[model samples]
Target: MVALMCAEAVILGTNSKDYQIYSLGDRIFCCAPSTGIERGIMLEISNQVECQYRERGIKPTMDQVRDMLARKYENVSSENVLLVGQDRHGPHIYAMKGIGIPQTLIYAAKGKGRDDIIGYLMHNWKKSLNLAQAEQLVRTCLLVGENDYVNMCVIYKEKETWAKAVPQLEPVAIMAYDTESAFDDMTSMGSNLSN
Candidate 1:
């Protein structure tokens, strides 16, 4: 799974398992999966994020990297998230989703249950009143998947500060931050996994 935030160009997404934040020439090249774990996640996440940016003068980058983690280890997977906008008040910060933008910042648990991520995020919202403190408000959130009980999380203090995915084997190994990093990851593995 993958995620991104800009508070710049209005966070958009091109969800792909093989994501690699590439630093090409004048422009950075983003090569992520056109399809994969991020199947529906991208469309839904992006639309919501964009809506949050509207009327707020907040713009997310189209080139921002998505995904929580990237790994070269064959057994490692990853989950990712990023922030893009400021708080309703302009800098202090708040979640894009919590601030009346329901889908902008989604945090769904991988286990069994409906919208566990939503419930978890809402809980944090009330506790901290600030995404920063709210994010730190970690809980042993659980979800029952068909085959496993995954405990996942997505914490964001603002548009720029966030921690994606819990620790289900590190999610998808979201790695390769910059262009160089993406290049190395691609050359090393050649598998589907990027920013």
Candidate 2:
């Protein structure tokens, strides 16, 4: 029941066209489409990777993403996943999956069969918006059965403004950090990059 139910997930991976990979702490920020359950699996991956990164002080690669996911998921393949978007301003979201070798980049993976395939067609043809922009345009969404049957709601870059798209679930139990503190850290990192 849980495994088969429909859902949607978005991951914005910052792999600048040249296959250059960026990593932060124990997490990698990449966007992929998934169901509610799969999203949970990804969260598990993030948590595990965080611990590993802390102890070993290493960045997670596609293979590491694989290892972290292999235990809880089956039929694990890149075709079933995608790393979307570009994190132009450093690692915005440190989210990672898998734990073996490196997985190439793609935005979201569609499930097998007609509905999924056609849904992708519509997403590409009709919507005409890149994953990032589309993801940022939603309020309330539900991923139902097939093709556009899914929907999404999110709090994009800003707090007051919310966007809704077809097929992303609003995350529960959110966490907030001090923006000023984070800004200071990023400012220092930027200086280091300049040097």
Best model number under TM-score: 2
Model 2 alpha-carbon drift over 4 Å, by segment? 1-44, 74-119, 122-195
lDDT of 1 by residue, 14-110 (tens): 2222332222111112222345543344444455445656756554432221221111112323223223333322221112222122123432322
Which parts of model 1 are misplaced by more than 4 Å?
Answer: 1-102, 105-112, 127-139, 142-195
TM, every model: 0.24, 0.32
Tell me how far the alpha carbon of residue 105 in candidate 1 is from the true structure, in angstroms, after superposition.
Answer: 4.2
The count of residue-pair clashes in candidate 2 stands at 33
| Cα lDDT, model 1, residue 110 | 22
